[model samples]
Target chain A: MTPSTDSPPRIYTAALAIIGNEILSGRTQDANLNHLAKTLNGWGVEMREARVVPDIESEIVAAINALRARYDYVFTTGGIGPTHDDITADSIAKAFGLPLVEHPAAIALLEHYYPPGELTVVRRRMARVPEGADLIENPISKAPGFKIENVFVLAGVPSIMRAQLQGARAFIAGGRSVLSRTVSVLVGESKIAELLETAQGQFPDVDMGSYPFFKRNALGTALVLRGREEARLEAAYDVLVGALSAAGIEGHPGELPD
Target chain B: MTPSTDSPPRIYTAALAIIGNEILSGRTQDANLNHLAKTLNGWGVEMREARVVPDIESEIVAAINALRARYDYVFTTGGIGPTHDDITADSIAKAFGLPLVEHPAAIALLEHYYPPGELTVVRRRMARVPEGADLIENPISKAPGFKIENVFVLAGVPSIMRAQLQGARAFIAGGRSVLSRTVSVLVGESKIAELLETAQGQFPDVDMGSYPFFKRNALGTALVLRGREEARLEAAYDVLVGALSAAGIEGHPGELPD
Candidate 1:
């Protein structure tokens, strides 16, 4: 299905910043961003941009300055750890010119997990929060996340991060999540080029893409169709499928096009 | 691996930015960071920070300004699509105070993909290059990527971005990679918390983590151990494993404790 000239068009926006040395060292694979994107999509929030920076203070500060000013809500993961490298709170504070002080609420939580004086230099790192920032609670762990302005600074550890965000969810913006559909075809992407061109022209409001993959040694293509308007997207998707059927290509009816 | 106490540890760095309005709109899930991280880890480069931005010019410029000055390399993906929202090229050029030029190499590659002038205003968006940047060749599509000072501009599509990266690998730094190991334990993370704490104390050089996961619907913990000093790390791992084995903990004989 495709959108006609009479239909209203669609758009989305998002900003993602991943903070971790483990990810950069090629030591670990990060599955969080993609997961976040999918979840946001379900809620109709667009993830507009993503950035990755290191564990350095200056670097993190600079990145915070850059993203906070550009995005509706800047989401950062990875550096809110109980270690020396966990400098996100201080960084965000520095970016906003706020004072980073040990918050009474966070200190209470810290004491629950760590006995007095057990929270060493590294562990104490997790308790510091900037002035005027609200706490994003962590049900799994005692240390809470903070939301200053619109930047939601969460823990880098997945479980802790998820719990904190769960507590912070309602305050975030909700949008009309656009619809998506997929059309798979056995024809080579090169062969399906003309049809893709036609589909795109026929439905300018919808985004149509041809992803070619190799399965069992033969070239296969998956055409992904997406749009904000449901009826228009459905229309363009149907037309794309019809064109694929006419071309004698066969695949699934509705898997992700990519 | 653990770092030798005597040797000063130096951390490698990187920055990532995802550019696209679709991502913001929750229309598409991004798989590039994980894939790219896998590649980066092979070379031991650490991804310090990441951000996602919408298809806005000033936003991209602002991000570029902050990241370029702080990290060894800044990577940007997406927004090079053949659509009105694809304004990455011009913004990148503008960010560096460089003039936008019809890059000869990129134009030639585009010509090879679709005949000269067959590219409309939308498609031509992929061909814009900032002055003084080297083109990064796209293996999936003919359109190439370009590199400015400390910045590698690649495609938004995963396959195309990956192919372009393969073409850009030679430009990475030549630092020796950080090494790590993983040991699985058939026990809950809480049960092993004491041992983990003890082991970390004994092997201060190793960074230890306990990751819990479900196998056959049963909970198990995987200890990921990382560091720079090979011998010290190996020795610590052995001692840590020995202690666990003595305590009836099932673990690898030589898998260093993380």
Candidate 2:
């Protein structure tokens, strides 16, 4: 991708819909959202929002519809297994008004994985995909995830989800990547709230955030600036560092607040 | 909380809005949602949904309004700090049409925590609360969280958040708590997909879920049944186990899917 010199760089935003009763019920702590967010960031895509919904079909349908409409890409994790409760593929089909068809490629993969006599009805469920969807290759498991429209359906297991994401990333079109810088202030965030707000106003395009952290007996804040333009981000970082020095607070580079 | 005998016992639902750029940026993994969900479940409240939004005011306002309107109770974490980026309190006030005021109790707590010369302008920011809101005590830190209408605003720090939650729990009136039982079958979830669906159909009121897991190169599924009625939940669990046994798969109790 060529870097654009347009006044405002192109911005690509994505959203995640985590579908699982296991997550909502607190039985399983979700590890996919963070992984996806970091991965997407590296690929020049911003994950703007994320929602964790139950395994219910209607809930999954609603979230997919809303997110796919609002964001450039919508990636859904969980609820794609071969169980009665695994309803993500069917829900995505319903959301897009497509038929749930058994994909030939997926069936072939499953057929090859399981013995000729072992391809039961339950195993066949894994081969079903939304009509006209492209298969997302899964190296760890033979059952493939599929992408329909702008929604990518991946397995819930962390390992499978990461692998599926790597495959899906190759097909995605990314915009200008976001550049970030974190400056750790040796004082509580409250002490520098006003200065941070002033700096944010000066750099309206850059998203500035102050996170307070406490570790051992020390308290500090990490001032993070994120923007699509590297030059603008560095300028904003300079402004933040200068403001901290003016307030008689020492700012350290690359030192994250606990 | 009373155990009710009424068929299809009352179910209380809640939604959480996690407000912070740290979480969205993947700089911080939110620890509040799972803790709150587990805690609320013990209080007979089911946390149905959760949304993670950035520190932007408009996003926070929109999420708070939507969640508060849909669920029985709405709990928000993060962004209620003493920083310029800590806009959760103001955004929440805007959402409910409440005036931002210096809460007397909050101010007193700050005053008591800081010495005569230590209460700076930034520190006093924590004293602001929505008008007519009741203070949710913060035992770890002096600054207090508050409750306005159906929404509860807590400190973003995990320790302070947990303490504030403990104080706020007493004011909530709980309905019938959900009873859950998990049966682990030493077979793939797809192997028994049809049976699970049929059992789910039989117990329509119970929230049935099947989670697939992989451990030590072995794959299995956990069948979970949740409902407000213990007898009904037990009945559903029995049905699931019986179905597994009929399918020649042994169902183990309390054995979690990996």
Candidate 1 CAPRI grade: acceptable
Off by over 4 Å in 1: A1-19, A26-28, A38-167, A172-258, B1-12, B112-125, B138-141, B188-206, B242-248, B253-258
TM-score of 2: 0.94
Compared with the true structure, what per-residue lDDT tens digits does model 2 show for residues A237-257?
999899889889999897563
Q: In DockQ terms, which candidate is top?
A: 2
Q: Pick the candidate with the highest TM-score.
A: 2
| Every model's TM-score on chain B | 0.86, 0.94
Off by over 4 Å in 2: A1-5, A256-258, B1-7, B256-258
Provide the TM-score for each candidate, comma-separated. Answer: 0.67, 0.94
Query: What C-alpha lDDT, on a 0 to 100 scale, does residue B232 get in candidate 1?
Result: 65
Residue pairs in collision within model 2: none
